[model samples]
Target: MRKRNVFYSLFFFLHLLQQASSDVHSISGYFLGSQGLNLPDYMERITVDDVGMYYYDSTMNAEVPCPEWLNTTEGQEHWKDINLISLDNRHRFASSLQSAILQFNLTGSSSNVNVYQGVGRCSLYPDGTLKAVLTHAFNGEDFLSFDIDTKTFIASVPQAVIYKRQREENPVFLEHLTFFYKKTCFERLKILLQHAPAVNMKKVPEVRLFKRTKAGSKVLTCHVTGFYPRDVQVEWVGAGLQSVEEEMVDVLPNGDGTYQTRRSVIRPEENPEEHKYSCVVHHSSVAGNVTKTWEEHSGLAAWIWISLICFFLAIAGTGLLFRRLCKTKDVGI
Candidate 1:
């Protein structure tokens, strides 16, 4: 039920992981805010495939769509309606925050503001099926949730039980949620996807393997960049077909039309060659998994550097001999 920063981060990470492991598209809406003017009074955001569709906050007081997210006529109308809805919700948000404060006895002066947030999201599977979830949080902790599949409310904390029971008793809000997520949300996303420019395509990501040594510690980093559709996997595979993973950051857009991400793993200090670790990537755009092997010590690269140095020295010697032949003794130092 709780979702603001940590919730969104973890949820989106799992969302992208699912995208890589399966075939599905999702749309999500977020409403987050504090109780008063000490912070953002009310904020709303929507996203598709991890790309922001629009942003709304007390500062902006408008649902400002990202550059191309509202280009289509239908999208413009949809935002206009959504903006009105958000405006009404912004007013309701104050009361909701106050209720949360009262629920937890968190009331205080204007300087000591409390926070509340909620989210609703739906994911469309490859077979055209959709699932929706709703969650609410207070002071950065989950309290209540709704499962669209079960059509029931769940209380994550004792304070949330009353609200859950109220929602379960009242059929109106539940019915509205069903319609909005199943019909309105899906239709809007489908329209937007259909209207995207023809140039948008699933692009194979460019992958690179590199290492960084710091404080006598070395680590191998797999950099995967410039990919499309927000679905890609980067992992470190070690000996005996074991998949070793550290903290792989979330996929982020490159401001172009593609996305980039990185994964890093510790480089073994002892007998590193015994592992033969490799960075492996998987994406729909790629025919198969892309594997890049890494080594702690690269003799081939050292030999290549040595060969280049020798070639350059030989060229310098030839130049020096030519200068002597031309009787030019004063070679510039």
Candidate 2:
């Protein structure tokens, strides 16, 4: 029984290893110098590093040859124009769509020789990602390589999920949701906006502070007036150029070539006097940059001082009127 159990375990492990190896594919190639010094090959894998990968072949180190044909003065000038020293001797082939041959032109040399040749094919993943691969024959040996530019599709493969309800045709829904009746259009609008991409509120409709509260908090709003897709963000800062807490409310656009947005932050609570606040806007149309801050000032203390001066003047005038009435009565007596 022990021997049978060990055999079954080994079989399961081998199956898993086979699946992993089958899932992997790679593209690689090496460069060789004129004197036959071979450099490192460029290599990339599909299962590892899902994002597209690239590398420059640089393994050759043999000295460049001064050919006998280019020994004259005119030949020397021609050699200067051709950067033969830094030239890539190997033809680099890129994979592509459809069954076809991969080709690259040899640079710097006048021979116009086709460096590398291969048969290639490309395919697209279900999630809109693309991959291309190629194979070539050299010196009676077969070589294979694959393109690593299908990152977006590879990353989109969904993670496996488990569901409690198995059957697709029969779904469990609350058997008629009852005791709910209200005429709220805004609720439906909110639901639609939830699935919509978040706006980069920091940008758009020129950030401006249009109003202030009695206690000394500035009201800021922005308009994203460009013809680009709507993506924006907003924030507030204090006089010291630091981020401050704020309460925000969403104001919808009127669909008349305008969008409305506003937010407010408590400023006077921190100073109660002459202090400043800034409105910052961020948006994607502006390359996801933030505003430098639209400024606002608080003058609550100044308004208090003006009210006190007016009250004192009214009291002095009342006392003067009483004195004048007494003087008039004494003169009549």
- What lDDT would each prediction earn against the true structure? 0.68, 0.32
Candidate 1 per-residue C-alpha lDDT over 1-333 given as tens digits, one digit per residue, 9 for 90 to 100: 332554454344223332342366667778876754345678787666655565677777445553564577777787777777678667767766776677777667766646677787778888888877778877667878887767788888887776677667768867877788778888877765665452246878888877666558666778898887777778888754322244648887676657889887767677775567788899878889888887655634655665666566667886765444445333221
The residue-level lDDT of candidate 2 at 206 comes to 60
Tens-place lDDT per residue, model 2, 37-98, is 13132211111111111122444354334345345564444334222313422322222100
Q: Which runs in model 2 stand beyond 4 Å of their true positions? A: 1-204, 214-228, 239-248, 270-274, 288-333
* Superposition TM-score, candidate 1 onto the true structure: 0.68
- C-alpha positional error of residue 300 in candidate 2 after TM-score superposition, expressed in Å: 10
